[model samples]
Target: MVTGRVARITDFGAFIQFENGEVGLVHISQIAHSYVRNVSDYLQEGQTIEVKVLGRDEKGRLDLSIKELQDAPEEMPRPRMIGRQSPEFENKLRSFLRDAKERGPGEKGGKKRKK
Candidate 1:
């Protein structure tokens, strides 16, 4: 963990300068545990914040994260499955398939009827 001052804010993330004069980037996704719509909402131009050093990027630039220093929120419950449908729905689907088959190839609604 290190203390850094937010040097600049961009559309994608914010740039921070460490005490040793090293610079790093705190990406929008690492701003918070929840969704972040705007970077300004969570950070300012000169705000001093504690950040975790996730690692260096492919280009050797420092990758920092604020959310990593904070506790994560609880996981949301998964949605329930719809499961099987009613008999009426199954019957309707079968009837529709039968009608489509009866209308075979080159039929009025199925395809252009040959003269």
Candidate 2:
């Protein structure tokens, strides 16, 4: 991991410079685990942050993700699985499809037949 100061901010990402005079880009996608709508929301110009090196891109510029240097994210709670594939579900779906088909032509809440 390298510690660097944010050099500049752009619509795409933030530029940072390390102690050894090497500069790298921390792309918006790599700045955090959550959706980053804007680069300035999570980072400020001149902020010091640690980033893990992900090697270089095609242009020889260093690619990094600040999220990698941070601690592992907390596990989110999984939704309760009530075993979705029950025989009852299949029967209900089949009946609904059949009824929707029979009532047809914009009246059964199904698609209207293309003219």
Candidate 3:
């Protein structure tokens, strides 16, 4: 683990400078385990942070991750269906499917056929 100061914030990620003058990039996905809509919300310019070195990329640039040092959040519960649908709803769905099959392909609703 090495200490680095955020040098710049961009749409993709943040650039960090180490004590030895080496710089690395902490990708937006590496910033946190959760969804990151904006990089600025998680990091700022000149903010000092501890990062784990993930080694160099194909271009030999340093690859770092802050999320690797932090514990992951608990898994969210999956949503499940609670009850069966009503008879009326089932009837409507069946009717709709029958109408759709009758319409065939590329046929728009309420469109009249040319002679």
* Model 1 residue pairs with clashes: none
Q: TM-score for each prediction?
A: 0.70, 0.63, 0.72
**Among these predicted structures, which one has the highest TM-score?**
3
Model 3 Cα lDDT, one tens digit per residue, 61-107: 99999999998888855578779899999999998888778777887
For candidate 2, the TM-score is 0.63
What would the TM-score be for candidate 3 when compared with the true structure?
Answer: 0.72
Put down candidate 1 lDDT per residue, 1-115, tens digits, no spaces.
Answer: 8999999999899999988999999999999988899999999999999999999989999999999999887885567889999999999999878877877865657443556
Off by over 4 Å in 1: 77-115
Residue 14: error of model 3 in Å? 0.6
